[model samples]
Target: QMQGALEQHLARLNELLASRGDYVQTLKFTQQLAGSIVLQLQGLPAWRGVSADLTELSGQVAYVEYYRWLAYLLFFILVLTVCLLACLGLAKHSRCLLLLMLCCGLLMLVLSWASMAVDTAAAVGTSDFCVAPDKFIMNQTDDEISAEVVHYYLYCDQSLSSPFQQALTVFQRSLTTMQIQMQGLIQYALPLFPTAEKDLLGVQQLLNSSETGLHQLTALLDCRGLHKDYLDGLIGICYDGVEGLLYLGLFSLLAA
Candidate 1:
């Protein structure tokens, strides 16, 4: 009876070992699928070129913006000083102060016109680019990215399905199936085959890591994250930067 029972346990272990080939095949496919999805994401313009450029551009813009504020403040103080000199000259009938005021007024006029001209030109150029930014971006990319991909990110319509949704779904299903198999072996076969405990726990740990990767991949594949970055760059350049220029232009006009 003991020999018969030993044979029965060996047969069950053999069946489980046979099924492992299928599990290994599924794991191999899942790894390939993950690699393909990552490559596809990296190939897109949003990830490859646009994101890097925007990050660098943001840093540059911040540096320039700091100096711009300083220049504006100095100009404002100069204008105020000239106005005070003019007031004192008129009250005291002082010829020397009046002469100084006249010279400073002429200099202010020239600077004001130059600043206004630059601001107008910049505002116009920015407006032109904003009018049909999609075309401009497409042209710049030189046909490297498809229009469909660009539109998907630019619009970010909820109705549109994610590009990697199918692959992610398959990955999730395969992973879950693998986990279930591993758990079954840990529960049922571990008592019969004590040596397999270490291998089973190791596979469970690997599957857990894969699950974490899947979550990260899903977040990266989502359009909203990239779209938010795009919008932020536009707001910084178009709205904030241009608005500051307009304020500077107004100050120039007042100073003039």
Candidate 2:
């Protein structure tokens, strides 16, 4: 029975790790898409502000990656230290080493409890994020893009796929139609209303700037921002991280 339980726990651990790997891959893809969007639009004055947000997100992703590996290293070292102390105490029958090992084990127990508390809070926060991710996504949006429109992009699963594709198509056609209308205005209306030239010029600049935003819009319309953040938080806090904390808790109990 003990062996069976151990096997089951190990299997669950493997499954969690595999799921975490998938989340990491998704995060990498999201980072790439965000970088591309930022690169494409940041040259335009319209995109300057959002570009900073994207940069900050990318930096956060890098930090996540860094801290993940760092945690792995620390956990490995913790386990190694315990095993070494146990072996030394067993082979030499040293009371001093056993006392030191007990002291270290007690410290680990305290740390594990603290870590578990933090992880639990993080899991709760992530649960909240996953529940209403659209609100978070909308917060990152620029003034020019409506929150509803941005929501469509991040949540574009199978049901939404067709509608967004059609929206893009319609947007493109509208641009073409506006170009035709502008040509007519320049040719005929400008002759009688020379004063309208300034307004026309303003419209032209707006259209050009809109094109830059459109490029970004099409990219952001995919699952790159909020969805990624929610998934990352979900897996990082609730699954792999929490599982590791549980294992540490188990180890501390056993050591004590």
Candidate 3:
């Protein structure tokens, strides 16, 4: 009877342990389900929103960074070109050519200034450059029409801001002046030769004449005084051929 009671007690203990294990498993399952629900509810939307926000911000930064790189590349190219030109000028020992280049640069600067004054963002900055193969740089400003009476300065050159108006204007005045100067030059001076051909028998004679002309040209380029005289002579003589060049010179002087 004692042994049978001990066996019965042991069986009861085993049953209780099994019941506690079941209870603990059920509680763990509930806890796991609750944790899963809370995690999905909290993390899914939060992660999605965070991911989208990060992508949007990253795209903006990338776009701005691209523009900055493009701007830097363009700046480098411009500097490289200038350096090459300087090297070429120095190697050739052509001071007169250098002066002419300087004059042209000044003229360009003036035109750029005029455009900028009329519109704040005229020569698009390096950062603003685009990769379009064909570009149209048209003067399209709404205020340009109403800007008629404004007297603006293109560097040192004073000009009417508007391309219209019957009033005193710088560009129109330049045209009139150039025409007058041309009329005087064509009145005198040699008709320009068509070609510089040479005969086999008279090679030395041709060479001697060429050498003399080259020497005179070199002497004329020795100083600014002579250079200016040659340039003034050119204004009256090469009018039809180099009208653009003359205005460029005038613009340069005005700018300087």
Where is model 1 more than 4 Å wrong at Cα? 1-49, 141-146, 228-244
Give lDDT per model, in order: 0.72, 0.58, 0.38
Tell me which of candidates 2 and 3 scores higher on lDDT: 2
Indicate whether candidate 1 or candidate 3 has the larger lDDT. 1
Q: lDDT for model 3, on a 0 to 1 scale? A: 0.38
lDDT of 2 by residue, 117-211 (tens): 65556556666666776676577584755655565556646455533465555555555454455555556555755655665444445446656
Q: Write the per-residue lDDT of candidate 1 for residues 46-126, one digit (tens) a residue.
A: 555756776898799789879877977877787999999999999999999999999999988998888888888888888
Quote model 3's TM-score: 0.25
lDDT of 3 at 210: 35
Cand. 1 Cα-lDDT: 0.72
lDDT by residue (tens digit), candidate 3, 12-80:
333433444543343244334333433433331123443466589779968975984585465345445
Best by TM-score: 1
CA error at residue 45 for candidate 3, angstroms:
7.5
Q: Largest lDDT belongs to which candidate?
A: 1
